[model samples]
Target: SNQSLLTQLLSGDEKFRIASFPTDLPLNGMGSDAPFEFASKQGLMTVMRHVHLVLSRLYPNRPVFMAGRSQGGVAAILYAQHYEDLAGAIAINPPHPDPELFRFTVQYLEDKANVLADLLHAPGVTLHDRSWEAYKTFTPSFDYPSMRSLSPILTLVSLGDPFNLFPQYAHALKAFTENDAKNQLYILDAGHNLWNRKSTDTYREVINLQAQFMVNQISKVRKAC
Candidate 1:
């Protein structure tokens, strides 16, 4: 029910108009018993349904861009893959639903459990089943949610994100948009931990970058019309 950490941070920039909220009751660190499927679908649909609708009504003539961090990032990318209601979408260090990702991330973490669920469990913070099951067998993985078919999204990568390094971030950014040349892949010189002071500053920079990208995308769209 609260605005996301992303919103809290981005609100500092008065130049930008922000309308950020939880992707679902399950995300936003609220925690949920939502099974694998519901966790994935609910997050994406909340944006497509509630958030987008609210923003569209508020700014009917304005192009709306969506951006999310981590799980929220996954939702943003997934929403764009299925719908064209957004002007553009940006995902920052979105960890894919891949078992290998967790397995690989273990080498850098103190907890080395190989079980996907346990490996990712954050105790009382948030996230469902550590998202391992959803990553492995979610319906989207089987039939429709192919990154290859996704519209161009600004995916920012962190070379230091243990769970999703720049190289592992490849598959997510492999897809080309209609304007192939504009599918920009930016590698930031920072880690994925946005909780600390240093990381938080980097996140601020990322938000600024996202704001600039959105302005450019909106301009291009207006020009094409």
Candidate 2:
């Protein structure tokens, strides 16, 4: 289940060399902070910087594409926005900055503190002070208009997902990229995890579609050169 959509793509396509990196944030209890800290702007930026540094050193001359799920998806979008040389970005179920959602998540965590503690069972699982500050400062939804100027973005959203606030986020992103023919927003009939269906048919179809889009974009760039 840890395998992502990008992983599926890489396995199916032999011509493309893909790299997947961890967020390296405490959000998943992998760090000192409690779960969900990685949802903050600070957490996202930290991962983005790490990704940029790695890519710069390892594949400086090669065209790079970013793709991810949930918070990782948000990071991919942000990275694509900052780097003009990126071929493109594919974000699945990304969450935008919404004050109400933030408030709701904080409240949910607070109410479920004991449950979270039991689940994570790691050191420094308490909420970090910086997370709250980052929430107030790093709202990406406010910058959607500027993001329209960045590289092409393809957003895949699931209509059945009511838990992650993705529909609104995808709608706003689609609006920003409305004028760009290269950018697209695709809606799926599943939930937050698009590949959760018992039948692999839907998952295979989505992955194939994404792979085709990425190939087309890469071909266009090569022709332009």
Candidate 3:
């Protein structure tokens, strides 16, 4: 989803490669006897570690553009946070999990028809307990500050999204990230799916802007080198 548009924006002129990590059990449920779920905070760190290894082996010298939708978006930010060498990060409708926003969004969903709880209770929901626990943990008391010193974090969201409530997030996350490197948030007219053809196209435009900025920065750095 991110690659197709990223390529389109470079006028079909840039080279982009994509890889995905297979989902693993929550740490220990599958084979090892170590608890499947470890510290919640460490989850991001674990994923970033894998990304660092992949980049080290695959593109030792080339710049990388990291992008993802939803959870992937969160992972992208986590990756950029750990790996400053990332050229840029583009995340769409990413869940930020701010307490204030989470409180309000959960209320909105419950009032809208218990969609929040229903999703949590869904039979097929993977990591259901962990996800719900995380959801509850994010309810208005947690100090959720946006991570500073990360690569450019561009958040693409939909104003009309009934599911994610990106409208409520723009301010909360932005305020937390204002002092960070080129942090940005853009809103579209569509719903939760940031990759819907129209919404995805709009999201890509923002990615293009960030990519250009990163490219220019890289050029300057290369010249200095």
Candidate 1 segments whose C-alpha is farther than 4 A from its true place: 1-16, 25-43, 97-103, 106-145, 148-152, 170-182, 194-204
- Against the hidden true structure, what lDDT does model 2 obtain? 0.60
**What does candidate 2's lDDT look like per residue over 101-180, in tens digits?**
64554565556555554533333455445554444345434344455436778878776544344445456556755866
Residue-level lDDT of model 3, residues 1-225, one tens digit each, is 545535554534555554444443232111223244334446655766676668768867666666766555666666667666676777665565666666676566546543533443333323244444544453233233555645666777766555465455766666656766567666666555444455556666655666665556566556767
User: Clashes per prediction?
Assistant: 0, 0, 2
The Cα error of candidate 3 at residue 10, in Å, is 3.8
TM per candidate:
0.63, 0.64, 0.64
Clashes of 3: 2
Misplaced by over 4 Å in model 2 are: 1-14, 24-50, 100-146, 164-170, 179-182
Which residues of candidate 3, in runs, are more than 4 Å off? 1-39, 113-130, 138-146, 163-167, 198-225
lDDT of the candidates, in the order given: 0.56, 0.60, 0.56
Looking at model 2, the pairs that clash are none
lDDT (Cα, tens digit) per residue for candidate 1, span 1-225: 135444453435534455655554233222455433444465556646577888789878777776777666667667767666578878776655545654554344424333434433433333344443444345224222244423457878776655555375455444433235435657676764543465577777776678677766765777888
**If both were scored by lDDT, which would come out higher, candidate 1 or candidate 2?**
2
Order candidates by TM-score, high to low.
Answer: 3, 2, 1
